[model samples]
Target: MLLKTFRWAFAVTALGLVAGVLYDGWTALGLVAILAVLEVSLSFDNAVINAGILKKLNAFWQRIFLTVGILIAVFGMRLLFPIVIVAVSARLSPSRAVHLALTDKDRYQELVTDAHPSIAAFGGMFLLMIFLDFVFEDRDVKWLSWLERPLARLGRVDMLSVCLALIILLVSSMTFAAHAHQHGGGHADKAQTVLVSGIAGLITYLVVSGLSDFFESRLADEESTKSDGAGRPAVALAGRAAFFTFLYLEVLDASFSFDGVIGAFAITNDIVLMALGLGIGAMYVRSLTVYLVRQGTLDDYVYLEHGAHYAIGALALILLVSIRYQINDIVTGLIGVTLISASFYSSVRRNRAARE
Candidate 1:
């Protein structure tokens, strides 16, 4: 089962490495390997979150995710997205951005780094909303009951998650972003950029998530009324609901990729190498998500979702902090892995107790 799931990931890794070596010899190959590992470690939580969502879609959408979705993730997010950022931020044309990336990698890296504040704010706020909604929602299976219970009760207040996210964005903008601008002496107003980007992020989350939930709920209601002869809602989501859900997943993947894309510069500034490495990692993440869904990992280990959300919350905060301060990727990766491991252990203990 494991081999069946990861066959493509392995194939990609082999091809990516061979391409890397042919492009720039052993040095490039090493950097590619490091960057691939970095992306996988940083995005393990993302795979978990994606599995939770991807399982709702039908096999057609799942195939779309593994095929067309991967093309978008690899080329769009890992490669073209950075170029787009540079072009927009630096007021250059698309072709010029590509030229700069290929010809002047150091300058390319600088422009990308200069754009980090807005990127972080946007990605941070989007992820923050995701984490907030998860924690605030009332779930029968609670991981941290003492804390989750209170939050769930407060969640009954309509739009509470949006309210809290906006407040946090405001405070972060006024405090961290403003302070960073004053100390760093950047020409742009970091605070203003952060406020604008954060709001954009918040609105994006609302639109994508709201539309997805609305369509999905309508589909559920429709499906609930008509079941198979065995008396079950059709096991797959389809139509507009599936489209929106797929859209939501892509946006979620983009938000998660922001930091990794920028952080890749620290290892290597070659655009082709970055794409090859990150693309391999992304393939693995998608494979892992499919494996979890097919294996029923989440159903068996209920708290795993909770832990991934908490890791997401931590990552959201880290992204916000990174706008003003530098954070080691290792630290970010360790925090996520730790939370997931703890939850897995707890799930095992619960299973053992139930058996007894």
Candidate 2:
């Protein structure tokens, strides 16, 4: 089963390595390997979250995710997205941006880094909404009951998640402004950019998530009227629900990739190498998501969802913090892995105790 699931990932890795060697011999190959590992390590929580969403999709959509979705992730997010950011942020044309990337990598990296504040604010707010909504919503299963229960109760208030997210955005913008002022820089433009970017992120989450939920609920209602022989509604999402869910997954992926794309410059500024490596990692993440869905891993290990969401919350905070401060990618990766590992251990204990 494992081999069946990961066969494509293995193929992609092999091809990526060969491409890396062809691009610049051994040195490029090493960087590609490091970047691949880095992307996988940083995106483990993403795979978990994706699995939670992807399982709802029908097989057709699932295939779309693995095939078309991979193309968008590898070329769109990993390569073209950075170029787009540079073009927009630097007021350069698309051709100029590509030229900059190819001819002057250091300058390209600088432009990308300079754009980080807005990128972080946008991605951070979107992810923050995701985490907040998960924690605030009432659920029968609680991984961190001590905290989740109270938050769930508070969630009874309509739009509390949105309210809280906006408040946090305000505070973060103010904090950025203050930090800039302290450093003897103009704060107005920076603060305004953060505020606007955050609102854009918040709106994006609302639109995408809201549309997905609306369609899914409608589909559920429609399906509930019919049943298979076992008297259960078909749970596989299709039509509009599947489309929106797929869209949500892609946006979620782009948000997650923002930091990794920027951070890849620290290892190597070669765009082709970065795409090759990150693409391989992305393939593995997709494979892992499919494996979890097929194996019913989430159903068996209840708290895995909780751990992924908590890791997302941590990442949201880290991205927000990074607007004014530098955070090591190692620290980010370790925090996510630690949360997931702890949850896995707790799940094992729960299973053993139940058997006893």
Candidate 3:
């Protein structure tokens, strides 16, 4: 089982290498590997988030998430989305755009490079909405009721997420529509486009994050079970609702990965490199999710999940801010790292206190 499983990972890596060599040559392939590591490292929180959801899913859905989810991540988000953006922004026919991207690497790079602001803006906003909804909408009074109240009341992360999405929708579509009207008239109005795109990014964050939280909470309600047997190892079930819970988890993973995958193009656009580097990082995320689930980290740490979720909420806000601000991904990664680290320390301290 282990060998067979390991083979899948090996095959994906090997295939990515072959694709890179055939398409872009040795140097590009090297960059692909490097970028993938960077993406995975930066997105460890994604795995933790995913695992929290995966534990709620049924066995079949888990397989589907691994298989179909990987396909979407690699082909759809990583490969196609950038190409689509290039095609539209560069005013080339779709086929021509792709050819340009592949053969005329310099021109292609120039075309998409400037689109980063828009991408960052969109992702930032979307993530902010998600973070807000989860933290603010669902408030329980643990020992930290005093703190939780302030956090929950201040727009409730979930509500903020929804509002962000609506704001982005109004802003992006309006700009695009206006631009379409003015298409061949001037300096391409890239700045205005970037601004609109940034707003749209915030909107996307709101919608995706809000929906994810809504669905997750609904599933949690459906899965609510008091039986001890329900909370078993590998996957603890609050009830048969675990199936829906799992589904919600997968969707959540998809949402968190959106920015990571989209932002990756800034580093390099070779599909092969994107796949290999991001794929490896995703593998570790998968591993992390499974580790978290198997270790019962949530049950033990209690507030660790809370802290991570809160951190995710913060990240979403940061991403929203980046729509206009252009905050570096490294800074974003550091924010997440700090939150997770703090949560980890808290967990350890709690454990020690219990033992004492």
Candidate 4:
């Protein structure tokens, strides 16, 4: 069963190595493996959160998520997204931008990094959806409401998260904008475009998220009305809690992927390497989720979900902090791992205590 579960990962890894060797030789292939391991290690907590959601999803969506969803992560977000950022900021066409990525590899990062605002916008908007979805919902079996209220009294809604995002925008604009300006006027116009793109992205995030929430609530109401039965969904996937849990996991994955995605740039800018490195990490995350589901880790541990959610909160803050500090990726990865590993260990102790 374990081998079956990892079959695809092994295949992907094998294929990736083959591709790397053909393209950039053995050294590059080794780099890919190292990057993949680092990505997987950094994203372990994301796996636990994802597993929690995968347990609730129907088989069809699960397959779609594993297949189509991964493609989105690899090609759409990882590859195309960066190119899009480069194009929009540099005023190049998308096709030209991609050509630049392949040919003038030297200029690839210069173009992309110039579009940091857009990159931040994509990641920022996605993370915001996650924050609001998990933080705002009313849930019967909540694990994090204890921490949610003080944040709530600040606003009935999860205003704090929004506040945090706004503060980030303000700070980023203040800091990066000046630096961008100092870089001079020719780049100045493009920098403004990037800055505006980030703001636009934030606004887009608010609109998209508000709509998703509205539709989800409506669909949920309709589903609840139909289920006029006695017991809840046998899987405990029925209530607001479950919905938020699902939302939380998706957003958590997005958050965890943020650094991996950004840091991938620091590696070879080959789309294949980004895909393989992050894809391997993604595969482990998917497996970890299944492992947790099969083991009933969340149910058994009780506080595990809380710890993970708290970690998400901290991760978000860390992301915001890193916007300025440019804190090295290794340190950021370590902090995330330490918090999550501590949570997992705590869960294990609790589980043992109950068994005793």
Could you tell me how far off, in angstroms, the CA of residue 45 lies in candidate 2 after the best superposition?
A: 0.3
lDDT of 1 by residue, 1-356 (tens): 99999999999999999999999999988999999999999999999999999999999999999899999999999999999999998889999999999999999998888888899999999999999999999999998999999999999999999999999998888877876643245534788889999999999999999999999988988887798666567658888999999999999999999878988988999999999999999999999999999999999998899999999999999999888888888999999999998988999999899999
Q: What TM-score would each prediction reach against the true structure?
A: 0.97, 0.97, 0.73, 0.79
Collision count for each candidate, in order: 0, 0, 23, 1
Candidate 3 residue 345 C-alpha distance from true site, Å: 1.1
Assess candidate 1 and give its TM-score to the true structure: 0.97
Q: Which parts of model 3 have CA positions greater than 4 angstroms off?
A: 1-7, 18-26, 138-147, 153-269, 324-326
Q: What is the lDDT of residue 13 in candidate 1?
A: 98
Best by lDDT: 1
Per-residue C-alpha lDDT of model 4 across residues 1-356, encoded as one tens digit per residue:
67776677778778877887787888878878877887886676677667666767555556655676666666665566677767876789999988888888768777665555445544554554455546565544444456666545554554665666666666655665444532235545544544565566566556655654565565556666666586233333444444444444454455467677677777777766777667766776676666677677787766566556555655555554443345577876777677676767876776687789
lDDT per residue for candidate 2 within 47-116, as digits (tens), equals 9999999989999999999999999999999989999999998899999999999999988888888788
lDDT of each: 0.92, 0.91, 0.61, 0.63
For candidate 4, report its TM-score: 0.79
Question: What stretches of model 1 exceed 4 Å from their correct place?
Answer: 181-188, 228-232
